[model samples]
Target: MSKIYVLDTNVLLQDPHSIFSFEENEVVIPAVVLEEVDSKKRYMDEIGRNARHVSRLIDSFRGNGKLHERIPLENGGSLRIELNHRSFQQLQDIFIEKTNDNRILAVAKNLSLEEETKEDGKTVILVSKDALVRVKADAIGLLSEDYLSDRVIENDHVYTGFLEVYTAKETIDRYYEKGEIQASEIVTFPLFPNQFLVMKDALGSSASAIGIVDKSRKKLKKLIFDYDHIWGIKPRNVQQTAAFELLLRKDLPLVTLTGKAGTGKTLLALASGLLQTEDHGAYKKLLVARPIVPVGKDIGFLPGEKEEKLRPWMQPIYDNLEYLFNVKKPGELDAILAGMGSIEVEALTYIRGRSIPDQYIIIDEAQNLTKHEVKTILTRVGEGSKIVLMGDPEQIDHPYLDAYNNGLTYVVERFKDQMIAGHVKLIKGERSGLAQLAADLL
Candidate 1:
């Protein structure tokens, strides 16, 4: 049965094309949602861009008919703007204020009642990305759901790019002797390109080997970089080993690393970037960039030039670089950067509309980016350039993003089948025992 879906402002802001997502169902837009979108269109961020796009999309639907009335959509659905001025009387006892959220709820409640009195009753559902909005909708006896059309993968089933398989001890011995084995000889399931493997004896013996699926050869080959350390930073666990191997490979141009805080996601990427750019001179320069997302309350704005203004937002990147370069004093790191002239630290905001060639680019805190934002960054990669995206998906700070739908997760899932891409989900927190416990319990 076709149902009515009332979209929240946040839903439109997160995905401007959400109106077309519900097939053959009536999409209702409350007047207050447009008001909210209008208020947010003046900002200078992704949300603002989406808000403007939503307004333009709604405006384009006017030629079909008045938005206050039902207009046929291209996808066999109909959309209409709910112009009924609803009061908070129905929810006055529970929510006294006549805020925008309450007003939206009142509209949905009135619509539900109107639909119920019709000869053919239809379900009215409120779709929102805000958890509190959904909870409030439930408290008022309104059916609601989270807007999940943009989510490419679920949190529980996120691809880790690695799995364990058990084979006979003889097969393992042959693999070690030949240094390669056909994938069909061991596992029955299909393996993705560059998918790492932990081959073990079928009897659960101590014999095991680490290898990766070579798509070109259709065989499991040994890891390329199993060094004791990559520029003094050692892999404390198997997942980290996989991450380092992916990071150091020249064949895999795009690498993604995910972990909890202190799992060495950023540290490992930076080390490999330095190893390739500074020590080996494989790339022309090393470029480190991250989104300028504030964690807590915004500290207003910093005064000075562009670099000075980005100092606070990019301090975490600086700290990682200092640790890798062994800078002891305050200005020592600056002197080293000035001397080398190969490392560049910039915000992700200014990276658009430029082609970067032969550079080792590292985009940190990538979990805070949207799919569109990440696409824009990736398309800027010029010839012979390598880009690494690393972040802890569990610690996202973006208001409209979460663990599963963010850009980091999107790239990891979409690129799992490609040979030029590799990923590793670091499970162990090697920072400290207390930090690991906090990451687990808290």
Candidate 2:
């Protein structure tokens, strides 16, 4: 049976093309959702861009038929703009506020009642990204669900970029002696390009070796880089060691790192970027950029130039740089950065519409970005450039994004099979024991 889906404003803002997602079902848009989307169209962020796109998409539908009436969609579903059902009397006992959320719920509830009176009763569902809106919908005895079209992977099943295999004691010894082995000899399953392996002895022995699949040679080679230390910072755990190998590789142009705070995701990326750009002269510059998502209460419209204003948002980057460079005194790091002239720190906002060539680009806090935004950033990379996207998917600050749908996880899942791309999920938190416990238990 065809269902009626009432889309919330956040659903449209999260993905402008959500109207066409429900196939062979009726999509209802309350007038209040358009009002909310209109109010957000003036901002200069991703949400605002999506709101404007949604308006354009709605406008395009008008040429076919009246949106207020049932308009046939390409996917066999119908679209309608609901102007009535604004009455809040039905939900007055449950929610007193006549806010946009409440108004949306009112329309959904009204549709539900109308559907129940039909001879063939159809389901009326409210599709929203807002948790509170979905909760209120449930309180009022309505069916609601999250917009799951954009989710790339489940949290528990996220790719860890490495696997373990048990081999015979002679095979393990031969691998250690020769420092390489055919992938088919180790495991019957096909291995992804650049995928790391933990080869253990099958005789219940303690011998083991870390190797990565070299797709070009079709062989598993031992790690070449010294993981004990890189640019004065050492990998505290095996996962970090795996991440470092991905970061320092010149063959893999695209690398992604996912971990909670203090897992050394950003630190490892920056350390490798600096090592290649400064020490090895492999790239022209080390460019660091991150999304400008605010935490807690936003500090609106600070007084200063671009760099001065960005100082607050980019402080975490500076802190990591200071630790790597060992700048203890005030203004010391700033002086060094100024003198070196090889490092550039900017917001992701200004990164658009430019081709960056021969640079080691690091985009931090990438979990807050959508898939389209990440695509834009990746397309801007010019020839002979490497880009590293690092973030903790669980710590997303974007209201519309979750652990599975954010850009970082999206890239990790989409690029798992590609030879030029690699990913590592850092499990250990080197920040402190307290932080590690909190990440695990809390």
Candidate 3:
């Protein structure tokens, strides 16, 4: 007997194709889930797009049979809409609320109880992205699990975009003298495109060198900007040196930087953007954008005009800009930015319809973005544009996103092997001792 997997509304909103994730098992969708999806269908944001997508997908399934009954899915499983709310009243004794979450849990509990009387009783598992819903289900003696199909890396440690290997001291010297070496001669492990490496001496000597694999994955080349200062900010460590290698490379169109707070992810990206666009004359402009989490499409709640409403959300970027420009006045940086048409800071809200070309784009705090939201932003990159997405996967603000499942993590894993894409994970925080201590301890 196949197990029954009941889904939550968040699961569908996170991934519209998640209904087919449970293979060869019964997939149950509570009626309240559809109602919740309906309420969000007009949201005009990522959730809204996902809600509309789910609505259309279910409507197309009607051609097979009625949704209330078992509808055979192509994955060898059946989909059903549970219209009964028999367990809702029982949950009131414990939950004391009639929210949609409780309603969905009640449906799952009702099915679990009904299956217990059968000779070939099937196991019921409630799958939800919400932790509280699972807790409520556990209180009612029901089995529950997270919907983890969207997770990029299932391990505790995500892909760090770099590797450390112990090589013979001779190999390190030879690599430095020749400026490049055959990747097979260094390590036995598989080499990925643009994968940064820190080669250490195996003889217990104090010798080390940094390099990265080319797109062909055959040669390891030394860092190009290892010593040069990028817009008055030099590489403070080997990680930043590796980052500048990717950031200044016009050949690579996509770059992702992930690290803890105060690690200079945004600072380095801004410095590079300024150097390339203003000094090198590589791109036309520097465009910076980040998501306004929790209030994604509903910025009307904040008072003032569009720019005023966005000030709070965009302050972090401005703070970094001020540090780079050394502006002592309150609006001095703003005035300089206004005069310099080459730099633009804006929210990710209206980025859907525009085709950004010949620009250096930076998307900070990218972990707050959903997969769909990031995909939309990525598709807007046009010819001659280089997009840098940097964030701490450990710090996510989206309710439905976790460390390994947000847009930044998703893109890091998905594009790790692409020739045009590169990634670097900054470990040490260069901001300050206090900030680094807070990032690690607090």
Candidate 4:
């Protein structure tokens, strides 16, 4: 049955081409939605970019036909601008205020209640990225849905990159004894490149050294760095080892690591980045960045230059760098930073419109970012650049976000198929005993 879908501003902001997402369904853009999109189009962030894109998309569609009137889409659907909605009248009867949200709800309600479009009593459905707007639409007897066009992975189907397979005890023994085996001779059913196998002896014997082998059964080389002793830092766990592969792989331009606190996600990424950019000549510089998420009610003002103002948000990255450098004094690390001139700590706020190539980019605390924000950062990566996104999804602070919906998880889910991307869910915490216990218990 043909139904009209009234789009909210957030849907367009979440995905600019959302109009084309609903296959064969009529798309209706209330005049109020344009007002909202117009307000956000001038901002200098991802939302603004998407808003402008949506405006341009609508303008392009004008060449097809008048948007104010129904126009046939290439797909078996049509697009139209709904300018006759009387949401203002309905909302005035209840709230008596012409609020933007109320006006949008009224548009949806009017369309949904229109008798001419009703089919078995279902006329229209509203799509939005804003939860409040969906709730308001439902309250006014309008069908509503969240705009999930940007969601890359379905619930419970995200790639883990590891598989549990039952293998013969004799094969496990031979693998350890020979230190290498033929891939075809092995009975492991599923194996991915660089994937680790526990190889538990079915008969129960202490036989295990983490190994990754190629299809030819040859042991693949582990990640090695040229800087043997520039700094005494070492990877403390398997998660860090896997992270090193993602951070150093020139072929893999995108990497995402998710785990709880004390999982060594940030430390390993930062350490490997320092090794490649500072110690080795792999890249020209190391760029470390994180989104600025206010812990509580925002103070709304800070006085200083970019670095000083960014200090409050970027202090955690600085702390990890200080620990890696083993500096004793407060300003000692700053002096080292100045001397290296190869390591940079900046906020995501200023990363837009910059071309970053031949650098190891680490984006910490990535769980607070949206899908749009993540896309913006990934698109800015030029050739010969590796971008690593690390964050604890459970520790997300964005109000409109959750563990499953944040940018880090979205990236992991979307780019799973690309050979150039790898994802790791750090299970163990190697930070400290207390930190580990706290992470587990809390």
lDDT tens digits by residue: candidate 2, 292-341: 99998898998899999999999999999999999989999999999999
Tens-digit lDDT track of model 3 for 151-178? 9888877778799888899999999899
Q: Among these predicted structures, which one has the highest TM-score?
A: 1
lDDT of 3 at 434: 96
- Off-target runs (Cα >4 Å) in candidate 4 are 88-97, 116-122, 164-166, 182-191, 213-237, 245-254, 352-358, 368-385, 397-407, 432-442
- When summed lDDT is taken over every stretch of 10 residues in candidate 2, the lowest stretch is 147-156
Give me candidate 1's TM-score against the actual structure. Answer: 0.97
TM-score of 2: 0.96
Order of the predicted models by lDDT, top scorer first: 1, 2, 3, 4
Ordered by TM-score, highest first, the candidates read: 1, 2, 3, 4
lDDT of 1 at 195: 89
Best by lDDT: 1
- lDDT string for model 1 (121-142, tens) is 9999999998999999999899
Residues 285-355 of candidate 4 have per-residue lDDT tens digits of: 99999998887788677899988899888999999888889889869999999998999999999888999
Q: Mark the 10 consecutive residues where model 3 has the least summed lDDT.
A: 292-301
Model 3 score (lDDT) = 0.91
Q: In order, what lDDT does every prediction score?
A: 0.92, 0.91, 0.91, 0.77
Model 2 bad stretches (over 4 Å) = 216-218
